[model samples]
Target: MNKNLRVPVGIFGIFLIIAITLTYTLNNLFYLVNFLYIGSILSIGIYLFVINNKYGRHLVQFTIGLYMVIFLGIILQENMQLSGFFYYLFLGVFQAAVIHYAIAKIFGPVLFGRGWCGYACWTGMVLDILPFKTPKNHERVKNLGLLRYMIFILIFIGVLILFYLNVPNLDYLMFIIFILGNLIYYAVGIVSAYILKDNRAFCKYFCPITTFLKPASYFSLLRVKNTSEKCIKCNKCINNCPMDVDMLDNRRKRKNGTECILCLECISNCPTKSLKI
Candidate 1:
């Protein structure tokens, strides 16, 4: 096998394991099919990326994002949002939303960092098409990240209120929230992108999902590394990074390291090819 193919194969194998395990444990064929579909698409995207296809990441984003947002969320009425995760958790149901959160949002980050944000996020799929792929201002706004925490807390509280009130037709309400929440996210994300001149402005400042994604991703097994010997200090990697990660630092605590989506812009932009996963 070619060395470059290893990562994509490994990714597919991991998802295959998850699919088989969940199918057996939960006695649901949907788990097997859903995960297999997602795994295949992701593996193809990674292979395209390895071959230096510039749109590989976007391809994955649209395929998986549209499936989750349109098929699972709208057609199946599964919600698939933070509110839906909480609702399913409260009901003790190990369904689509719960399984998705567990695999894609919570525990999965320990291995892949914010790969979900880069390759599979429905919100990011839309945002990445915006004009500002790289922020005009290379620095993040001070203290704006606190808004994610606030939004996280508010979602939790709102879910609690629904459960406490024993809201009738709770499933319907959650589905409604899912639609409205996505609309609001898209609206705010687009507006913020233009205002801040950054495509990921919403992810940086307002996404409640990051509150779950960042901590585990800090210890992610996959991360970009820099080879100092090959580096010419050209700073192209940093300048090209959408997340403003200090990829040259080669430390777990590197500036904005937790924010890295493993997008590989730094590697692609490196003049000396000093950066690698």
Candidate 2:
């Protein structure tokens, strides 16, 4: 029962106010330069900047703020389709060959410590909107953390099989699956955060992107680690960590956990300020 959530309720309230206001204002003016879309971006940007006041230093907030900036950029650009950006490059049917070649055949991690989760994941943004306090029962499901790799392989294989067969409606199928998957994921995330008191079980036990990022993130420069002899085992670091990593445990083992997202929440919220880069 951690019972301490850094994210405040007023944050969501602000988002709602802005969203509703923009919806009515921009939707009504939809004919005027497509202000609806632009207004939505502005509304979200204002909300994030305003909400940052509550959890300005938290890692989750930092990650979310970074993503909002990128998303706003894309929405404003008008040439870049957000769905295409995600599907074509990062997590679409076409990406299988690139992922397999880089991660499997070449035997290299994809990035470094799943930094993508912190930066580009739209699903993570959805969860970041919810306010929940306390860590959940992430004790240990199994030692074969490699299960996620197996899942990725299977998904890649399915994509390849369908590709070689020249299956009709493939793009449409992928689009449908993508939309449904996101809906289910965010639905689950919101429900879990509300009822189960944990915001990140989706990241822990389920996210396919997390699996992709795992191999890539080992080589990333942006990562999380405890400083030299600074932590006092106050558990603030662990408590504040959205990813449920036992920072104290990492300190004891002289390693950063594989799931670390480098969001600065732990460091900022630590009472002794022992949590650091």
Candidate 3:
């Protein structure tokens, strides 16, 4: 078997394990189908990426993003947003948004890093199509990253307030908030992209989910590695990174190491093919 093919196969096996485990533990067949679908699409996308298909990553983004936003969020009213996670959590419900957050935004990052941001995020799926695939200024805005934590705290407080007040029709209200939250995310993401000339401005500066993703992702099992022998110091990889990760340095404590989303833009642009995952 080709070495590159191992990545997708390994990823598929991991998802299969999760699917089976969740199905058995929860006694719900929905988890089997849900995780199987996600795994299949992700495996296929990774396979395409290995074959050097330019549209491979986009394929995963669109299929998974649309399914989450349209089918889960809108049609099924699952409210898979950050607020929805808190809502389900506060109600002591282990299903729906809580499960989604656990597997995707929380513990899962320890295994796959922020692959969700790269290939499965509904918000990122939209922002990626903007004109700035790479930022005009490679330097990140000073202290702007602090906004994500503030937003995280505010959302936590907002949910606590709702639960404290015993808000009526809470389920329906969560659905409404989910829709409005996505709209606000899209608006802020797009506006920030144009203003910052970086397609990932919202992710870098304002996404509350990063508060969960970043901490665990510091120990991600999967990450890009750089070969010093092949590196000619052309700086193309750093120049192309959307997340400003210093992937050239293989150390775990490298600058912005936790910010890596596994987008592979750095690898793809590496002049000497020095970067790999």
Candidate 4:
């Protein structure tokens, strides 16, 4: 939320305002609405790279807000065909796109990492704003983390099997299943986080996005690093991590956790400036 970033952020906001207004006021040329929407999405994506300030996080939030509004518009379309229904997938894809870009700048770790997750994701947003207590630990189920890859394997196999079986409209079914999968996956993550007292336990184990994104994030240009020289071993970073990553342990071991989201909560909160990047 640095003051310097405000101007660009404000400009981006204004662009979105204009786009929405055009869609509503210029109904005669509604096709332009999609272009306007894409423009806004691109603006928000670039805003992340423009402003290193944490306030850019809200760009992600606002994008989702815009997406949901447009999603309802699409869903409300008259005579909407199944093809039209598929556009709903854009909601998730757009979020992924934002993260994909953000990670690219930060040197890449998907699943929205700490930057996009803390800022843009509706599910993560809800969890962050919730008036409740939650734990951040994976020690109990750390071994189970491998299950996500297996889940991915099963999903891939299922898609391949359906294709081999000559399933009609398999693409449509796959799209539907993908949409359902995101909803169910996030729902399960949120509910499980509530029950298990861990905010990202399910993300660490069950989320296919995390499964795929984690590796991609590993190869990403940007990554979280520990500046252990200043660490006082306060353990705040570890305790505050939504993904249950033990930053202190990583620092101690001279390693970075693969699950690190680069959320910067650790860096911002670190009294010693020991946790950074």
Candidate 5:
């Protein structure tokens, strides 16, 4: 077996376990289909990444991102946004957005790092398509990163307020909020990309989900590590990274380490093939 194939296979196996377990426990086949589809796409993307396909990551993004936004959010009216998660949480419903947050946004990062941002997030889906791929570290606004936590807290408080107020037509309102939220995210993400000259500007500066993701992904098992022997003092990896991760510094506490999305841009750009997951 090719060494590069191992990670994809491992991810596929893990997704299968999650899918099967959810299906068995929930007695709903939707869990099986949903997870199986997600797992297959992720495995395929990782495999293509191994084969050096430039579109490999984009393939997964479009596949999963479109489904979540179009099928789940619009067609099904599931409201998979951040508000939706809190909505379900306050309602004590263990379905839909809460499950997504638990599995993808929160706990999953411990295993895959910020894979959600890289591969599955609908917000990132649109942002990745914009012209700026690499980050403009120089132009990054100071203290703007604090906005993410603020946004996160505001959203939480908003949801809690709604719960306290006992709003009527809650389901319908959530669906509407889902649509509005996506529009706002797209608008902000795109403008920020152009303004900051960084495609991931919104992610780095304003994504509230990072509040959950960063803490757990700080201990991610899968991340890029560089071997000093093959490193020729070239800074290609750092220069190419969209998220500005200091991947060459192999330490748990490396600068911007938790920000890594496991995108492998650093790995492919390495001149001596020294970087790997």
Candidate 6:
């Protein structure tokens, strides 16, 4: 294979494996179709990025984002939210929203880091369109990251209570909660973006899903690395990083290292291309 084709080909092959394996195991043709579509979209996005299209990342985000949000969440009523995860988990069912959480936000982080946030997150698609793509120091207030834990605990507790109460029409309730949850997420995301002057304020400060993503991503096979030789210490990478990741620090345990969304903004901003993802 041509070197330029390596990334896309690898991604396509991986998704093919996933598609085949899941379809065979689950005896569901939908798995094959679903994975094929997502794979193709991601492969195209990767190719565009290799060719240096300015909107390559955005293309993937919007394509996968809108499909997951509208088709799965709204039309199919799949409930692809944190609450949905808890709801499904409590039911001991491995299908639907639980599978999505396992593959995208949980174990998937170990392989691709927070690539979902950059490429396919419906919430991020909306948040990234805000004015503040790059966050300033003042916008990142201290201790705000702790809020995600609070949100996580609250979601878990809320779901547990509902289950304990033997709530009827639980599927209907989940569908409603999914809609309401997304609305609250968007409202909070937009408000936080404006107030913090950072487009990713909601992601950095209060996304409950991060509780799963961060720890796994710490051991991720793919992550941005910084080399100081050609860096010039210009601070361009830090300035443009939406996640406030210290790309200048090469260690995997660097401050906010687990927060990297693999958005490549820092790499794009580097004068000497010292940053590699």
Q: How many residue pairs clash in each candidate at the backbone level?
A: 0, 16, 0, 9, 0, 0
lDDT of 4 by residue, 1-277 (tens): 8764564465456545655665566453442454355445545554564455555455555665345323522343221111222332332333223322333323334432434444444455545543333364436564676787787677656655665687787646655664565567668777877777776656566754454455465554445566578777887766665565666654422233556655556666677878655
- What lDDT score goes with residue 262 in model 6? 88
**C-alpha local distance difference test of each model:** 0.93, 0.50, 0.92, 0.51, 0.89, 0.89
Candidate rank order under TM-score:
1, 3, 5, 6, 4, 2
| Candidate 3 lDDT over residue span 85-198, tens digit each | 998888899997898899888998998899999999999999999999988777889999999999999999998899889999988998999999999999999999999999
Query: Residue by residue across 1-277, what tens digits does model 1's lDDT show?
Result: 9987998999899999999999999999999999999999999999999999998899999999999999999999998999999999999998999989998889999999999999999999999999999986778899999999999999999999999999999999999999999999999999999999999999999999999999999999999999659799898999889999988798899999999998899999998998878
Task: Candidate 2: list runs displaced more than 4 Å.
Answer: 1-112, 142-147, 191-196, 228-230, 249-256
After superposition on all CA atoms, how large is the RMSD of candidate 6? 1.3
* Winner by lDDT between candidate 4 and candidate 1: 1
RMSD of 3: 1.0
lDDT of 2: 0.50
The true-versus-predicted C-alpha distance at residue 136 of model 1, in Å, is 1.9
Local lDDT at 10 for model 3: 85
Write the number of the candidate with greater lDDT, choosing between 3 and 6: 3
lDDT of 5 at 7: 81
lDDT of 3 at 152: 95
Extract clashing residue pairs from model 6.
none
Candidate 1 lDDT for residue 128: 94
Q: Which candidate has the top score in lDDT? A: 1
Q: Report each candidate's C-alpha RMSD, comma-separated, in the order given.
A: 0.8, 11.3, 1.0, 8.0, 1.2, 1.3
Q: For residue 174, what is the lDDT in candidate 4?
A: 53
lDDT of 2 at 102: 38
Name every residue pair that clashes in candidate 5: none
TM values, all candidates:
0.98, 0.57, 0.97, 0.60, 0.97, 0.97
Residue-pair clash count for candidate 4: 9
Tens-place lDDT per residue, model 5, 152-178, is: 999999988988998998889989989
lDDT of 2 by residue, 207-268 (tens): 55555455455554445566658667777777677777776653423333667765557766
Residue pairs of candidate 3 with colliding backbone atoms: none
